[model samples]
Target: MQRYRMALALLGLAWAAGMAHAASEMPVPSALVGAWTLERVDNVYPDGRRVELYGPHPQGLWIIDAQGRYMMQMVRAQRSGFAAGDKSKGTPEEYRAASLDSNAHFGRISADDHTMHTHIEQASFPNWNGKDGNSAYTLKGDELSYVVAKPSSGASEGAHGEVVWRRLP
Candidate 1:
C-alpha cells in the first residue's frame, strides 16, 4: 500500500511539472507591431468627473516598428494655429491652448508578458522628456487597451487613466 501511494503522488507531481513547463513555453502573441489609432481616452478623475478629455471624437495615431521605436501624436481636431504664422511668435494664450489639447511622444518601448514601458526621449510636452511610463496592456483581436500607472487620480483604481487603440486596417 505504501508503494502504490508513492507511485500515485509521483505521477501527480510529474503532471503538474509538465503543465507548468508547457505554460511557460507558450509563445507571446504578436499583436504589438504595426499602426494603431487612438479611438478613445477615459480619464476617471478623483474629483468625481468622468470627463472625456477630448470631445466625443478624438484623432490620434501611433506607428511602432519592430525595432522598438514608436511615435504617437494626438490632438483636438481643430487646433488654433499661432496667429503670427511664426511658431516662435505665438502668444502665451495660444501656446497654452495648444499645449493643453495635444499629446505627442516619440521613443522606444520595452515590453514583457503583460507590461510595456516607454522611455520618452522627447515629447510634445517637454515635461515628459526622459520619463518612463509603464503600462499594463491587453490585446483582443483588433483592439489593444493599456492601463498606465500615471497621473494618479487618487481614486479607488489608483491609476484611473486608460487609453484604447485600434489596430489600423
Candidate 2:
C-alpha cells in the first residue's frame, strides 16, 4: 500500500513539472514577443496615391507578450492642442480633432506563419470593441509590416492601409 502511495506522489510531481515547462513556452513564436515602435503608417489608394494615415512622423508603441496578448497605440505627431485646456470643456471641433488624431487598442493575439489574428477586447474607438480581425504580416529581422483592409481613419472608401514597425532593443 505504501509503495503505491509513493508512486502516485512521484507521478503528481512529474505532471506538475511538465505543466510548468509548457507554461514557460510562448504561445506565439519567440520572434514576435517584444516592444515594437511604429516606423510608418500609410494608406494606399487604388489610384496609386499614398497618404500618411497618422500624419508624417507618427509616433506609436506596440507590445506583444509571450502569452499571446498585445496593446498598441499610435498618434499624429502634430496633433492640435485643446483650446479649452480641459477635456470636459472641449468644443466640438476640439473633440473631433482629438478623435481623429489617435488610435489605441488592447487585445489578445495569435499568429500563423503569414497572418496575425486579433481579438480586440476594447479600444479607444468604441466601435472596435469585441471585434476580431486578421491581417497578413511579414517579419524580417527587426522589422514587421502588416496591412489593414479597412482602416479606422485617414483612408478613402476603397483604400487599404499598411503599418510598419521596428522591434525595439
Best by TM-score: 2
Error of 1 at 21 (Å): 26
- Cα deviation of 49, candidate 2, in Å: 1.2
Q: Show model 1 residue runs off by greater than 4 Å.
A: 1-29, 152-159
In order, what lDDT does every prediction score?
0.76, 0.88
Residue pairs of candidate 1 with colliding backbone atoms: none
The digit string of per-residue lDDT tens for model 1 on 1-169 reads 9999999999999999999766433432356888998888767665656655555677899988876788988777677789999889999999888776788899877677777867789988787898877788988889989865554232355437678899998
Count of backbone collisions in candidate 1: 0
- TM-score between model 2 and native: 0.81
Over the full model, what C-alpha lDDT does candidate 2 score relative to the true structure? 0.88
Query: Using Cα atoms with residue i matched to residue i, what is each candidate's TM-score against the true structure?
Result: 0.73, 0.81
Among all candidates shown, the one with the greatest lDDT: 2
